[model samples]
Target chain A: MAPRSIFLLSSSRVHGYEFLEHAKEHLKEFLSKRKVKTVLFIPYAQSDYNKYTELVENTLKPWGYKVEGIHAKSNPIQAVLQAEALFVGGGNTFVLLKALYDANLIPIIRERVLQKGIPYIGSSAGTNVATLSIHTTNDMPVTFPPSFEALRLVPFNINPHYLDPDATTCHKGETRDERINEFIEYHKKQVLGLREGTALLVEGDIATLIGDRNAKLFLPNKEQAEFAPNSDMSFLLNKT
Target chain B: MAPRSIFLLSSSRVHGYEFLEHAKEHLKEFLSKRKVKTVLFIPYAQSDYNKYTELVENTLKPWGYKVEGIHAKSNPIQAVLQAEALFVGGGNTFVLLKALYDANLIPIIRERVLQKGIPYIGSSAGTNVATLSIHTTNDMPVTFPPSFEALRLVPFNINPHYLDPDATTCHKGETRDERINEFIEYHKKQVLGLREGTALLVEGDIATLIGDRNAKLFLPNKEQAEFAPNSDMSFLLNKT
Candidate 1:
């Protein structure tokens, strides 16, 4: 069976946290109705010795839910297989990628999340892993791992930490928009440019943007426009 | 002592070829007085082996200069150390990066080109390597190599193949400009947005644009503007 759904958060900025709160609400509702236990997985949490896991535990424990922290090695394939609801937190995308490759857990995690219907929630690095490839990650290539292949959970790419151009620094180098446009021009694939507080909630064949404001939609040879959150499923469906 | 000047081509596109021609002119002028020999390094020239090299060799041979093809493995350090004038052709940035890291050649190449002043030329992957990092490379992450550290010959990033928005596809993604803007916003670094048919020719502290038209310059928090080739030495000075 497919997991309940997949939630991709592009960043961990303040707005990203708010989106997490919204996701928590939905998860709580789903768990209450299903009468089942839920588990949140934070792979990068191990680096900080349960700092992230404790935060999630504290937030969800009051809702009568069971939260456990799986601090396995960089690759936690076994732990991922056993989790019901997996929530990956935000951190360095390159580090997360290295861990996934070192453990050879990319394929396992993808199968569990996509095929086993493991409701997965990812932010930052987690969100990057959900894409067809992690080529669009903004993190510097400080260290290269074995393979750049991502989870390929979605066909499009993800550009987290999407921000508007600062006119003052616009002349310093290639604007963020220009760099992403180069990718769009070359690949002609759909890429979700999620602002700090926005997310794409995908269930089955359905994807809805959940957040406070409209996210920017960029298409090849077209003028960029802002679309309200949860505006339409057309864009998501067309790409998928 | 630094070798004579070199030209870096951004791609093999028609525009890229035109830029190469323009670069050839400058290289010829620089060599005329000093009798400097020129070599074209086609790292991506895997199968079609003789086509690009022959073309470049034939073109420059008539000018009383010896033109040779480099067929070494992807060890960028070796390639840089052995050559006087280097011309890097564009193909796949990821592949080029993989080769550079596999041979552990990044640091040595950086030293030879940036510090020792080997006349360096790069286009496409070559140009991408000239930047602080390859985070803006448009290639997919099919495989991860050992390191993502680029030559960092320049302080800013490079966004080659910069194109305007297109509307024909149903794909929704971030624009090229937007992507670089995002990086600038996060890192406060400058990025050179080089359109097709544009090349950056650096000689000592002088980095000048060469080609048909002016290239776009993007800086964090500043308005993007077009500057004529060799318009100002201030930007290039800061980078060196």
Candidate 2:
């Protein structure tokens, strides 16, 4: 089954922006279109679950989002099943994946979101989990997960908060491009380098690039192409 | 047994320096003092193992040490057992760890170097494999390993190529300091941030920080401290 609605944001907050402020209107529109009443915020990525949940709830409260953290629930899997919509906030991807595994909620979440077409919104680490694997994440492996396998709602993985390589810098660390190329070298998955303030909204088979920045599609051993904002990236939903 | 003699370098070359050129004199002095004749080079971190091996060999050739790649040996364990010294070069830590696990050479190498006191030298990703775990690495997880567990040669892990947080940079990505802190938030192990042109020379139980730049030590929930060059970092070898 294709993903009904999956909004993958590059970050929760862009430069000079409030926490997920730019995404609030799009998020409300998305949820409204789907008639979503209840939104479950997965605060798995953050170290402080309470703080994360409170902040998220407060941020979306003005937009009329009945936001509640899954961490506050009794049975996480059941929470996912009951959630009208899901919003996963960003932090460390490894810790987030580990939390999913620890709660044994991967199967249920996949069923609830992918199969049932429950609207899912993710940013940063959250966006990483909606993809094929968390291998392309820029976050440190502060914790180990059961596996790098994600929901696989989309065929390709996302490299969020993507920054272009600094030409003048002599930093020894591999740039986003080099890291993604290396991933492509070993893995067959194409990676979407989604810059800040950008997102990919996947509805069934179509995935569209949102925000002002051009999304870079990194194909293995192939030249990367940039798609302008609001462009039809639906082709990404298809397996290459 | 604790690591008898382990020289872990942050990188093979600092900016403006030749391959391992900065540490060449130190390497010669280390090998000469130990009276080591044969050094087995582990080029697993690099994709092109042949080139990595030859480059390392040529770099150390002037010092009159026999540097050979372990990949060329029929029985790697036997080669490790007979080796007077071991050198692991840098590239990708994930690839290096994966190779170590694939070859099942972890135990043998541990036995030879950590237990038998065979001198070992590793730069960048190679140095990461000598720590308690590779959880603090700055490299990409291009490949998955059986576990992040390393040789446990040192009490704590080392964050190689540690860069000072640039105050002027507008980059949204987490700084090296932030990454190390995040690692400590979830993990109990301390992290030694070894900067470029820096090396940690461990003999018996004494580990000394060698380089001109000040190395940062990150302890969980504790303020990070900068250790001046050539400071006695032997306390790091002792488990807290």
Q: Give the per-residue lDDT digits (tens) of candidate 1, residues A100-135.
A: 777777788788877887777788778887887777
Per-residue CA lDDT of model 2 for A95-119, tens digit only, reads 8999998998888888887788999
Question: What is the alpha-carbon lDDT of model 1 when measured against the actual structure?
Answer: 0.64
Model 1 chain A is weakest, by summed lDDT over 10 consecutive residues, at: A167-176
Model 1 misplacement above 4 A: A15-24, A30-36, A72-75, A220-225, A234-240, B1-84, B87-118, B121-240
Model 1 over residues B1-240: C-alpha lDDT tens digits? 563254554454533243346456766775664446766465552234467677667667877777666654364456667766666666556666766677666786677776666666677777887777777665444345455557777766777766655565322234566666655654676777777666776677676777776678776774688877656534644843
- What clash count goes with each model? 64, 1
> In Å, what is the interface RMSD of model 2?
1.3
- Model 1's CAPRI class? incorrect
- C-alpha lDDT values of all predictions: 0.64, 0.87
Per-model TM against the reference: 0.58, 0.97
Clashing pairs in 2: A207-A234
Question: For model 1, what is the alpha-carbon lDDT of residue A166?
Answer: 64
lDDT tens digits by residue: candidate 2, B55-133:
9888788879888999999998888888989998888888899999999989888888878899989899899999988
